[model samples]
Target chain A: MREPTVRTQKIKKDTTRTRLIFFGILALILIICSVFCEYLTPYDPYLQDLKNAKAPPSLSHLFGTDRYGRDMLSRVIVGSKASIFSTLLLVGLVTVLGTMAGVFGGWHGKRIDTVLMRISDMFLAFPGLVFAMAVAGVLGGGLQNAIIALMAISWPKYARIARSETLVQKEAPYLKAARLSGSGTLKIVFKHILPNIIGPILVTSMLDIGTMMMELAGLSFLGLGAKPPTAEWGSRMSDARSLLSSAPWVTLSPGVAIFISVMIFNLLGDTIRDYADPKSRGR
Target chain B: MDQPALKVSHLTKVFTRKGQPDFTAVDHVSFSIQAGECAGLIGESGSGKTTVVNMITRLLDPTGGSIVLNGEDITRMRGKELRKVYARMQMVFQTPAESFDPRCTLGDGIGESLRNNGRSRRETRDEVARLMEVCGLSADFASRYPHQVSGGECQRAAIARALAIKPRLLICDEATSSLDVTIQKEIIALLNKLRREKDSDLSILFICHDIALVQQFCNRVLVLYKGKIVEQGEVDAVIRNPQDPYTRRLIDSIL
Candidate 1:
């Protein structure tokens, strides 16, 4: 057993509270963008504007026009729906599957653990992007398919993390105390180990959301994602690449959109990591 | 004489690390405690004090031993049978804070043993309060989490939990070592009070590194040196007229 550290007084002004508020606002904005994408944009992103082709940023068009005369601002706004949707779906699937697999693998050692971990190891051998790309290639091109592809490779990291956390938690004195007091194996794993390790997994999933979104964008740019006319960020970037010299805003708009979204997710993930850390609390 | 509350015969425990030679943790230790007797096992750290306690409480499997409680041999018990045996013999750990679940409230922690033994929630609630009252805890502490309480309060909570099951034997593994001097005294006094008031046939196996503490609480003392018992006698005799060299050294250190 570890010795108890001296309890420090709680700070009057909490930096963590401020960070949570900031992240909450960013998350709210992304949610709003996702739910009201169509109503928020003035012009249809798919409607071509031949008359205003390759126009610079001005009062009439906030992000100007693209090579095909499409409204770049409208495209970026509407594109968030697909990006956020796919990333969230991918994260949700991976978290549930990974946590269960990890808990079972850690709790029941020997043959079951060996088999589960071997599968995890096999997934780990391949780079996540390459595995996702291969899965995407085999499954063919679509939003749902892309999410499935990402999850196939993404779940291994979470499983490995959960398994290790479970292994450590299983040996804690409280767990033994619980067992001695007659808590069944299911109750011990779910009630004690799950709650203790879920915080880290949640933070990891939040960070993974940003990565999944980027991956989705990359796939779409390669013509393997949400197809043209769907107004996805990657598809827009793909269309604008050829006309980079004449219409730099076309490329820059989607690039900035992806950058801001990823930054918000990363910041949110960092704050969650700090807040969930037991060492940071009661200091 | 009435049947002994706990009986141990030829208890031996050996621990072997991977690719390392086997080491004896407890070498042929044997002892017995009558109902309501307080027996102390005194040793320095790594002297197998806890190892003996663990084997007796069924936390660790003894390599070769037979433990008979009330004429029942529990040396080979497993699963539900082992758990049933545990219900009759509870343990209070050295670190009070670590003994109780951090996530659970004090009352819940105390009530857990009862719940595990198949007591209903309502019955557990009432019994937990009664146990706490006996252990000198307020009813309001039932809702307070482990972290909210002081070290002394947590230790009291642990004692209350141990008593909840109405066990025939209580194994305290350096139970009050983590407490302050004043708190330790208070806990000792509380234990003595409870023992007298209940008139319970509760045998206590008090394991500690401090011989002085054992002298204050225990009727008999067993001195252990390097996983082997060097001396066993009345506390006064063992402390005052020590025959073993290890016992003399321990007494000199305390004095």
Candidate 2:
């Protein structure tokens, strides 16, 4: 092994430490919002205290009362549990499903490839969110149904990316060696092909997570997602629209939550991608 | 007097381009290498020598004719039968660095054939170590990746990979063409050593455009011109007394 320079090592260590602290803070926030959200909610999120409706921020109503007099801070905090975890689930499931289909089609590269790619193209030809909405509209409102709609359209993007990457990997000379090694195509695809393309797949997965969250929130905000009276971030913001002048806190709190969460996921993705790239890591 | 190690009977390859006339890369080329003979196939860039090797190794299917190894026809073998052919014949590519799957250690890359052949980990490790040593690579080179090695070393590793299967016929597709002249001479010597160390029955189909190297290394030579064999005989006989006009042209061009 070559001797490592102290200066370069220290720089690397500092960058790692910084990323660790950043993710640590985000993780801590997530845990607190998911676990202690109800305790933090001064008022029951579902209960409508019409008598105190449209009240301004005060000790009794920390983020001020919504039109239905629910605490705005409580609603946004409570909604975080649903949005955060479901986004994780959506990202995880879609990546597995998409990467599998894409790798399979790309490796096979004939009739199977043609059929799989054509199907993805058929779906992609329609605008992504519009198709998700159409599916959600048919399934009716709820987190699960909206998720299904989003997932149906979302997996194809990964499938296309993975498929193109697999095509490039297939041409690598190692594959010819693998064939001469007496290994079959399936073995070559799984053992050799999959690992090479994993980096880009992960980068794509990270980029998708934030956008998917926004799509989910947009669905709920339009009343096509979590249904009536569910304190989803989007649903809460929808209810707060009329009271913008009186209690801007009502919509603004959830809006800011949505924006921050999306930004965090995007930044997390960008930083991780840059870390994986050698040229970027040198700095 | 001995049975041919490899026989290609009127092999042909016609590439069909859309909306254009079909292109014939190698047309009606027939030759046979007797057991223990080293033959070189020499040609210019598009003379279709690589196409011939690809057809013989089953990398590309011939539009016509048969490829027989040790009297077993494998012209149209697929799946299991094709794999069996791989055990009988292996090819070393032109560029060694590009030959390996860069993701794996040299040990893993060289040991892959044995692994596919169902050799256990201990056996594979021993075999990889031994092959690396034979290829003139140190034991440490086994654990290193392709990028960490020099071009000559990479070619040696590639040769080791081809040798792991102990195939009867080794096909060299301009295997040393990418290296400098000194390394090329060294690689040619190593290949000669491999052939001599094995049974006298071991055969090599050395493919190159380098006529001088082919004249020195190969016992017999076939001069291909425009997908057709123009002249072939004992290397000394053909070089001293060329019959075909194209063969004369090829020899005259060497400088």
Q: Who wins the lDDT comparison?
A: 2
DockQ of each: 0.36, 0.52
lDDT of 1 by residue, B65-151 (tens): 799987789998887788788778888888888777667788888888788788999999999999899999999999998788899
Tell me the TM-score of each prediction against the true structure.
0.86, 0.89
User: How far is A259's C-alpha from truth in model 2 (Å)?
Assistant: 1.0
Worst 10 residues of 1 chain A by lDDT: A176-185
Question: Candidate 1 regions off by >4 Å?
Answer: A1-14, A36-75, A109-119, A227-229, A243-251, A278-282, B1-3, B71-73, B118-122, B236-245, B252-255
DockQ of 2: 0.52
